[model samples]
Every structure is written in structure tokens, then in C-alpha cells.
Target: MNKKIHLKVNTDLNATGEVLSWFEQINQPPLSDKKIWWQCQTLLIEGFANIVEHAHKNLPLETPIELEVLRLNEYIEIRIWSFGQAFDLQQQLQTKPELTDNFQERGRGLKIMDSIAEELNYLPIDAHRHCLFLKIKY
Candidate 1:
């Protein structure tokens, strides 16, 4: 496994910058293919946004979200822990969205994450503890 990088941020826009910096800090240089880089950026941004907007729904104003990245064998694992209302990704998946109806603007975040990451998991320990795991091949 390569060196792992971790970052934690408050429920604010600043988290976006932190995630972007992580991509640059990787040992490998940026990919020559803009498409791959763009997809990576999108996944990171959406993943962070989901944590802030969805997982941390009842987070205290003073507490920040905790995020950790683990570089494991053949994959990068991103774990986001939150001290807010817990939720289940499986529930979200069960309620399949209606693609033809474009009125509601919900449930898209997880969908996007599913697209980029090879695996995605949402676990809830209790009403106030939640964790999201996203894994992508490196």
C-alpha cells in the first residue's frame, strides 16, 4: 500500500479545497488524460458534499466532519465519519429514483459516487454516528 492521506474539515465550502489539494499531493503526477482527472475531482467533490450536506445534517455548529483516506492494496479507501443523524445507503438504493421525472433534486449524490468509486458503503452505528466508505482502484 502507498502512503495514506487524511483530511478533516468543517461543514463548509473549505472542504472542497482540502479534497482538491489531496489529489495534487499524491506521489504520481497528474494524469495526462483530462477526463480521468475530471472524474476523480467530481467524485471527491460529490463525496465530500454528501458528508457535509447529508450525513452531517444535525452536526453541531462547532464540530467539523472527520475524513480519512487509506491507500490499500489496489484501491484507495475514503472513510467519512459524522456525528449527526445516521442513515442507510441501502435504504436510499431501495427507493429507486424516477429518471423520467426531473422534478426532485435528491438522491443524485450517491448515484454520482457510485459511478466513480468501485465500491460504496454506508454504515450507521446509531442515530448520531454514521460512516461512508468509498473505494476506487488506484
Candidate 2:
């Protein structure tokens, strides 16, 4: 059977933990695989951190970010939305910086997410809302 989960949270540092907890709640026995679960969890945290760091960087503390997960028979889709500012994720994807050293502390989130996601796209829900969509096959 197909299932869906929805979460709405502030664009704060705490959102990362909330996202992880939500993921754990949905990752049940028989369906649980460590690698797949970690991939999804990582993507979710990266997406949340991106919005918190970039989109809401100068915005109000109460700004909201929305996350939705849809589970299908063969794959799962995650949609993340924010109303802070418009960002060109596609452009960012194309210009990923080279990671030469393990000590490099920046520019790896997008690349990692891109590698794991089967499909990734950015959609402007409206003039104010921006959405990042990611699909991963199990």
C-alpha cells in the first residue's frame, strides 16, 4: 500500500533533528534497509540545512519550511518547500565545486544529494514559494 507523510517546520537548526525523527517514524521493520534509510535521511537533512542556511538566512525566525514524503511500490518521492527566497537549484547543481580534500567543509551537500537522488528538480510554487523535489528508487 502507498503511504504519505507531511511535515511543516520552522527554518531553524532544530529542523534537522525533526526531519530525522520523522524519517525514523516512517522507517519500519521489514521495509527497513540501513543504506537506503541513511540515504534518504541524509538527503532530507541536506535539503533542510540548505534552506535554513541560504533561503532563510536573512529572513524572520518564524519562516516555515514544508516537507512531504510519498511512498510508492517501487520508489519514494520527497518534496521540500519554503517561502523565503527564490533559488536556482538547477544552476547550483551544474556548478558544483570540486571537493579535493576530506577537510573541505563546504560545497558537498548538493553534490551528495544529486548523486543519491534518481530525479531532482526545483519548482516555483508561486511568487513566494519555492519547492525542491527529489525522487529515489529503492
lDDT per residue (tens digit) for residues 1-138 in model 2:
478899988879876777888876556543566788778888888878887888788888788888998888777788989777787787987777644432468668788888899988778999888888888887
Q: How many residue pairs clash in each candidate?
A: 0, 0
lDDT of each: 0.69, 0.80
Best by lDDT: 2
Worst 10 residues of 2 by lDDT: 98-107
Candidate 1 residue lDDT tens string, 21-86: 865665354445666556666667777788777766566555676777765556667777777766
Model 1 per-residue lDDT at 26: 50
Against the true structure, candidate 1 has what lDDT?
Answer: 0.69
Residue 123 displacement in candidate 2 (angstroms) = 0.7
Alpha-carbon RMSD, candidate 2:
1.8
The candidate 1 region of ten consecutive residues with least summed lDDT is: 23-32
**Model 2, 16: alpha-carbon shift in Å?**
1.6
